[model samples]
Target: MTESDIITAVNEVFCEEFEVPLKELTPESQIFDDLGLDSLDVVDLIVALQKKFGVQVRNDERVREVRTLQDLYDLLEVIKREQTSA
Candidate 1:
C-alpha cells in the first residue's frame, strides 16, 4: 500500500479509538494535546497498528519517537518500504 493509504488506515484506527471526527485529524495533531489520548491510549494504538499492519513496532526509543500524526505516518512509511523490499 501507498504511504497515503497507510496513513488513511491509521487515521481510521485513531478516529475510531479516540471517537474523533475524520475532519478534525491533521498531520500536526498531537497525540495527547489534540486527540486527548492518554498514554494507555497511545499504547493501544501501537498495538492496533501492529495487529493491523503485521509490523513490529516495539522498543522504547521507537515508541517515544511518535509524538504527532506525521511522526506515525513517517514511521509507517519506513516500515512499508522495508516490508516491500523484504
Candidate 2:
C-alpha cells in the first residue's frame, strides 16, 4: 500500500485505540505524553499497525523508537516500500 494509505490506517487505529477524536491526533502528537498511551498501549498500537500494514514490527525496542505520529508514518512508509519491493 502507499504511504498515505498506511497513514490513514494508522490514524484510524490510533483514534480507536486511544479513544480520542481523529482531530486530536495529529502528526506532531506524541504517543506518550500527548496521547496518554502507556507501554501496553504502544504494543497494541504496533500490533494494529502490523496487522493493518502487513508489516512486522518485531520487538519492543523497535516500537519504543517511535514517539511522534510522524515517526509512525515514517516507519510504515519504510515497511510499505519493503513490501512493495519484495
The top-ranked prediction according to lDDT is 1
Tens digits of per-residue lDDT for model 2, 1-86: 66778778888997776678898789999989998889877778778777777778865355568889998898778767766789
TM-score of each: 0.87, 0.85
lDDT of each: 0.82, 0.79
Q: How many clashes does the backbone of model 1 have?
A: 0
Clashes of each: 0, 0
Q: Per-candidate RMSD vs. true structure?
A: 1.5, 1.7
Local accuracy of candidate 1 as per-residue lDDT tens digits, 1-86: 88889889888887776678898789999988888888888788888888878888765366687888999898888886777799
Worst 10 residues of 1 by lDDT: 56-65
Error of 1 at 71 (Å): 0.8
Query: How many Å off is the CA of 37 in candidate 2?
Result: 0.4
